[model samples]
Target: MATVSEFVIERIREWGVRRVFGYPGDGIGEFDGALGKAERAGEGLEYIRPTHEEIAAFMATAHAKFTGEVGVCIATSSPGGFHLINGLYDAKMDNQPVVAIVGQQGLDSLGTFNQQESHLERTFSDVAAYVQTIVSPAQAQAVVDTAFRTAITRLQPCVIILPHDVQGQKMVEPGPEMWQSRSSAVAPSIRIAPPLEQLQAAADVINAGERVTFLVGAGANGATAEVLEAAELAGAGVITSLRGKQVVPSDVPFHTQQLGLLGSRASYQQMKDCDTLVLLGTNYPYGQFLPATGQARAVQIDLRPEQLGMRYPTEVSIWADVKATLDGLLPLLTRKEDRSWQEKVIADMAKWDDELTAQAEQTYDDGVNPRRVYQELNKRLPAGAIVTADAGTTADWYGHYIRLHDGMLGDLSGRLASMLAAMPYAEAAKFAFPDRAVVCTIGDGAFQMLGMNELITIKKYLSRWSDPTFIVLVLHNDDLTQVSWEMRTEDGNPVWSTSQDVESVDYAGWARLLGFNGITVTEDDDVAAAWDAAFAHRGVTLIDAHTSKNVPPLPPHITFEFAKNTAKALLSGDPEGFGAIKDSATSLVTEGVERVKGALRRDDRDHGDDGS
Candidate 1:
């Protein structure tokens, strides 16, 4: 008879979990002891312990996104489970598959006052797709199996509560065949098909339109080629959501640009001008930017029926896989040669890309621009590097400038954009794929939020592993300038920016004190060299790049009313009071101003030159 520790190892093997991301704790002694025993038995499984449970969650999220597998993360009770909520929220919003196993206090102490006895199920209910507590040995196998299936089927995070008392209790030996058969259970299938009338109606709309566009989303995964084929047949351009950036290569001819707050202006313009809009596997949140009622006919195709017509009004909704729908519609539609519309959209894309790139290149006299630093990092990092980005300005910069390549794996805590996710994410990636480059980019303000506390965990990993190498790039802007900029009034007076002054600190000293290699860089030219040094180190390393705080994040559009209010607040020296409205207003104003300028320039160029 195997001990509970041995039973867990067998269970993990049955679940096909190759790696586990977590932090060991007294609450999880049974699981931890089982992991140790399994390691000794050469199970070929690894347990990656990160600095925090949130980081563990981030790492698990990245793994699922990159590998297309249900990533697993384990944590102890209450405090540990609480830390994982943010990352789980990210996974839920992004629709990534992840399974989190949280150890509970001993079953003997249930409902009686005890340490770490908070309601785990209630705490995680909002973020998880399914939550189950395994209180008895008889229910353990079934609960675990259900949790795995729920995670995959819903394409979201699931939580499994493992009580300590149950884990240590002896159980009647269930035959080996019973466990074997459970492990071999097949995943449920998703069947999708389009109604004949809806399909034909969509095809007719596409065939009749002179200008058509397709907006792709994460749901379009594994159908890139089919989408491109359909677009080619229709002579249409393509725009994608942020999650769908790499669905089709950026260099594809029909690729216009991304569309959203961090999206390019050209894509928005194309979407507005389109005669018919085909939403393929996308549930874009900003319906205001989409074609308004009666402006352009909307046709949607998706695997999930609920996504159809949920956000926007649609003329035709096809409940089918994007690939299948495209394949079925291709031969039925008329192929039209509309070179004029395609040329106009392409030209707009080029102009937007050029203008944004040029604006990002503008140098400030005070210090290095963080945008430039990110751009440099984008260019210098390895092609297949795993990059984790923390929230705030760093996330803004990464979203706008960092191009997603074929081998590169990147993750940003979208909905739960908390600080300190990057470090633990990097640690997990390093542990999972020791050969791949693991890097993290974080802001100065966000870095300090959970920085020092996690260093000990990182140090332990580095000292234990032989070839430990994880590179962290810190954008040392010296202040929470994102908030400061929001507080600026219309007259350029800063009303709320004075709360925090830029304080210079030796970030490298802190890293060295934490038993990791650290390099501080101030010059623009030395940034690449410093990165090279950090990457070359055989342990955890930090590159602190001192950057300018005044550089603004110019999004694609903003309303005039918002801009006026922000400007008024800044001018009145009440910037902080308007803090809630500053970031959005500033982004809108900056982008709006740039867009107007570009439009005026184009109008002048068209009207000034020779008339064809």
Candidate 2:
């Protein structure tokens, strides 16, 4: 004699879901009350109630990304469902499997314009791969199954809407083999390979080229070894997209960090100069950074067929799983003996690293350079750590500085590019892998938006993690720096102070108030000390890095158009701010002089002699 709510929870648990991220409201009272009873009985799913429904959905999406599990989130109707949209879009745009269960006003009040009434079906139609509402208890079990299956199979968000009254109904099971319908928990196991002809065609394009650049994306997850082996055979240098940043280890000789606006000069050069481009598991949308349409012969492998040739025109496109396709195609690729192209890519990466380090080390009179905070973070990041960053200059610094060692994990809201995801992502990562260290880098705006309220959620759940190494790095620039830079570069206008500047708040003080080990730093020398102290603690730490907004998030390879717009903006107004930007820019340009000197010294030492 179980209630429909209880039956639904049991069904999801059978699908291997142990955690449910959500918030409670009167709309979902039946489910919430049942969950409490089950928890008291020691049979309920582990429920994590984030401060806001939006964060609950964010946690669910992040859970899917970090754990490769079908993440589940629940919310009440109308406003609660409305808040879940942004986070649901994060999963949809990034292609993660997430299932959301939303409650609605009673079925009897369908057309009554009731309080908290919502037409969740029409609202969720776009974000969900499959969305359905259950009118009967019999539909509860099957609806959950379909939602989860669709999420896993398509790697997209799916929705299940339950009216408040429907959840209170008694669970029903169909009598043996009648006209009554039922569904099972079995989901399809998916690992696909493109046809031999497709794989061979892709191989032919890659094998025939003298210089190959492999642009890896998020789809390459769990296929790093196969990718590296193929790279060696094709004599290709590696360039990871932002989402694919962790696919290749940071230390690989020919593996350029990332490619695009927040990428490396090495990656930019390799993409521009390469004769062949082999795209793996990534649909990197920035075509401008890629070779001009027909400059290179290209082969693309993606799970989605529509993505195959949509971004960059490909000579051969394969619809297949990245690892499976690579497994079949590896033997066909010809191994190249020439190492010159790869060596040059490695050298360019070294020079870029030097320049970036110089940029990070540049002193600021007003505040600590944000680049320096990420640089220091990279230096101190523990082995096998999980890193998450908010959207803004935080992503730029993360892209440039943090070199994710092998086994390390890092991700963000890439396509959605939303804020307030960093803290939730970090918390989800920590929950998924309690033994691992987790870090979140966020800006003041994002941190203030919802991150502050989630501190209480984090503090409440602190005891759940065995390793207490969750660190939050908040950039206290008191400005929405990314938009400021965008206006300067894209619109050739000065920063609109009223819109761009954020009010200064004591970020560290709030963290301390919440019982986290909070530290505020403004000077260059204190950066390393702050990181060290945070690592040394046996609890969560928040480092309020008072960073300078003036130091622009410089693009890896600036186009002439960008340079011109930047110059125009600098001359327009805001001379004092632009002057600091000029200094930061100068350091990046002239840092190569030091790198050249160091390289020459190494060469002279190699040729010089004990023979002397």
Candidate 3:
């Protein structure tokens, strides 16, 4: 008879899980033993032990994102289980398929307040699609099956709580023939498709509109070709949600930029002006960025029925795979002859590109410009490189300036927008695809928050990689710049001094101590060369580039109120804030002035008769 641990591992292996990101602890001995035994055998699944439970969870989330399979992570009871919360929430919010196996105290403890025992199912209910405890040995197989199935089908985190006693119990014997046959059955492949009537209804709505805008998301990843075809036929200007940034290539003719606060001016204008919006598998939560009610009609399509119209009032909702739905709807679409709307949006995108390029090229007074760092990285990015960005100023530069080329994939920390996910995500990407070059842009503030320990995790796994090409770009601004902006906006000056202040550390030296190839970049001239050196390094590398904290991540459409409030706060107290505002405004005005001068010169030449 197989022990519960053996059976559980066997089942997960049968489901095609190759690696389990986890850490061992008190209540998980039996499961740990099983992993070891399997590894000793030729058919073992690799058990990668990260330094912390949170790192393991993030790694699992990234694994699932990089691959289409359900990623698994494990942690021991109570505190260990709690550590998995942040990463699990990250997975849940991002809608990645992840399975978390939590070790619980012995079943006999019986509500006596055992050490490291807590109500895990209750804690995880909000974050997981399936949350349950294996109360008995008989329930083990069924619980595992359900957890795997639910996570895969729903594309969310699933939790399986296995008590110490339950994990040690012997699996009940089914007949040899029955067990052999049943064990081979993996999770079934299921595809969701909408009815013909619903598809036709969506098509009718889309066809009726003169100016259509397509907002795509993560769910539309593999449907790029089909999305372009549908956009062409419908005369739709495409805008991506941040998570869907790489879905529609920036090089595409009709494709604009992302939407919401970190979006582009072209995207904002497109959404504001479109008559009808087509949401293809993207439930972009910010309704403010979308067309207000009564302004435009909407057609939302998704695999999940509940997600339909959750963000906006839709004229028609179709429950189906994005590509499949598009394939069915395309043939019915009335091809539009007027490409004026699309052409105008594309031109606006070109102008926005020029603005961003100018912003990236401009040098800061005190330090190397942050945008220039991304610009340098963009120039040096290897073929098929996987990039990850953290949530502060680095995200601002990465999101605004870096252009994703074809065949490249990336992770945007979606709903959580959590700090320090960049390093873990990049490390996980490297682990998942060792051959691919992995780069992460992280802020010094976020690096101090959760990045140091993860560097050790990378060092631990670096030796295993045949072609390790992991690079971390430390945008060392020495402040919580995002929070600083918030403080400057509403509160007049940052009062939470400890929270915003980041201690200056030689990150390159620190990385060197952790056994990584370290490079420090302080000058603009060395930025590209530093990145090239990091890429050329055979192992894990870190490039610490000192950048300015004064720069702000201005939104695509900054309201007068926001600017007024910010100016009020800055003028009232801080000179740095005043300087930032003055410099940014001056740069924009200067660019505008130059453009006007160029326009006048062109007009004069056009009207002037050849030197007469």
Candidate 1 per-residue lDDT, tens place, 431-455, comes to 6566777778887776776665566
Whole-model lDDT per candidate? 0.73, 0.88, 0.82
* Local accuracy of candidate 2 as per-residue lDDT tens digits, 1-612: 999999988898888999999988888889889889889999899999999999999999999988889999999988888889999999999999999989898998876888998678999999999999988887787788999988987889999998999988999985555555688888777578888888889889988998899999998998999999999998899999888999999999999988888999899999889999999988798888999878999999888777889888889988889999999999999999998888888988987887887777788777887888898889988888999999998999899998988999999998999998999999999989998999999999999899988889889999999998889999998889898888888888977788877889998899999889999998989999999999999898999999888887877766688878877887778544556566656655566575686577568768883434
Measured by TM-score, how close is model 1 to the native structure? 0.85
Residues 273-296, model 3: lDDT tens digits: 999999987889888899988788
- Of the pair 1 and 2, which is ahead by TM-score? 2
- What is candidate 3's CA lDDT for residue 234? 88
TM-score of each: 0.85, 0.96, 0.94
On TM-score, the leading prediction is 2
Judged by whole-model lDDT over C-alpha atoms, candidate 2 comes out at 0.88
User: In model 2, where do residues sit more than 4 Å from their true spots?
Assistant: 175-180, 575-578, 591-612
Q: Candidate 2 clash total?
A: 0
